[model samples]
Target: MFIAIVPAYNEEKRIVTVIEKLEGHVDRIVVIDDSSFDNTVSLARNAGAIVLEHTVNRGQGAALETGHAYARSVGAEFVLHFDGDDQMDPHDIAPALAYMKEKKAQALIGSRRLDEHSTVPWFKRHILLPIGKMINHFFVRERLSDVHNGFRILHKSVLDSIVIEQDKMAHATEIPAKIIAKKIAFVEFPVTFTYHEYGQGTLSGFTIIKDLLFSKFISK
Candidate 1:
């Protein structure tokens, strides 16, 4: 069945809205709480989402891996990574699922860059994102319009093959790199989004680059 895994931090206020909007869109909604200090787990369960938790704050990447693992354990064939911060539209769900089947792809990535209707801040549109695209392209050698959008769909096999080692924001960069290294069939779908300011300033391009360097080069 189709399952959506939402990784959330201290998003008690927004998690309920995200879960409710995803209702009837996917078969199951699983919220992976990254040791959130707030009542995110309780609210997610109250909102009818299957809630999972990390005893420690393992970051977004770890939360996602936990959710994916749980989705697979529950026999989920199609898995979608959704944000719990209420930044994305739940309407993109159906099209992304359909695109996965149409392209016979193992993974489907939603790109805000492809949608004319999407909008973002000037810094993201002209600065951070372009640098991200260039860095991602350097590794994959593919022209991907967007690299950091977390809206993604993956077949169980894709998840099985790709191992997420980064425990934080760098996992966003690591996932696609592993997919490219393994030659997995993935397609980028057009998806619209609204960029919010919450937690947006935590990491910068330099931080991402430093993490990427450590994970891709030094760690190895």
Candidate 2:
């Protein structure tokens, strides 16, 4: 059984499209609403996703843990960690999962390097991307173009092996570190990140900068 775990916080506008896109690919779509004040839960349920609502806003890491636990409890064989902002392309799901199966890898990260059409901002490409790569190389000892990408596939075995300790944005860094520490086979597949004007930078740039620093420095 393949499961897709999408962590959403007040993302009512685009969750429907995200759910609809995963329709045939994923056996079950679990959307964890992280204490959103909006109608995210109702909209997700109406759009055919199994919804899990958190009473308080615990951040993306908490939401993902909730979904991952639920997926494991329900006997999911393979799991896809995704974002609810409609950024990830659903078409990458099958191929990415197939790569993991073929390689017998415990985890497969859908990297954005293969996307030649990405229009990422200059700062992200110039500053953040290199910083992320260096961190992955130095700490995780894995050479990958993208490190903090939220789209990835994991086998149940991998999920079982790693304990997610981070409650916020650090899970982006923590997951890979845990995978490597356990000597799990890790592979990276290129994926495209779609930027919707409505969704891009929905949070403040300063807030994103702060979280990026926290994930990179403080979380480590």
Candidate 3:
């Protein structure tokens, strides 16, 4: 069966729409609420998602790890890692999933390069994108255009093989590195994205660099 794991933190305004749009696209939609202070859990449950709430505010990485683990325990054959911030376009779900199935790859990462209609910011396109690509290339040995995208599909084997220790955005960096170390077969699929203002900069560039360095080399 197909499962989508959405990690949310206090996202009440748009969770309903995200869940509503994903209907018929996935078998099960699991919202992993990272100790949200708002009504994220209740809203997700009411919107027809299986809500998994964390006791404390662990970061997105922790929430995603919990969601994927629960999905595996319940016998999910295919898993889609998504965001609850509504930055990812739900329209990409169907085609990306179909391509994943066709490729039979252990993991399929979403790249904005595939979507010609994607509108990215100047700083992200000029500075952050290049930095992320270089960092991911060093670890995965593949020059991926978008490395930290949360929109991706993973087989159970790929998810189970990689160990996620980063508790924040750094998990994005850690995951591909683990996949490369495990020698898992992965492919990149183009996906469109929408940048929500509130969700775009939870952490600054310096903070992101610190997290990436610690997760990629220093701490890990």
Please name the candidate that would achieve the greatest TM-score relative to the true structure: 1
- Show model 1 residue runs off by greater than 4 Å: 217-220
- Model 1 residue pairs with clashes: none
Expressed as tens digits, the lDDT of each residue in 1-220 for candidate 2 is 9999999998999899999999999999999999999989999999999999999999888888898899779989988998999988898898888888899887988776766756567767776677666755665666767867898898899878876766776677778878888889989898888776533232433354455456666442
Candidate 1 has a TM-score of 0.94
lDDT of 2 at 197: 51
Q: What tens-digit string does per-residue lDDT give for candidate 1 at 1-220?
A: 8899999999998999999999999999999999999999999999999999899998888888898788778878999899998988999989888888988999988898886767787777777778778887876567787877899999999878876777888788788877878899999998878766633442665677777777756543
Q: Count the clashes in each prediction.
A: 0, 0, 0
lDDT of 3 by residue, 71-134 (tens): 7799898888888878788788888878877887788888877667667777777777787678
Error of 2 at 204 (Å): 9.7
Q: Which model scores highest in lDDT?
A: 1
Q: lDDT of each structure? A: 0.85, 0.81, 0.81
Better of 1 and 2 by TM-score: 1
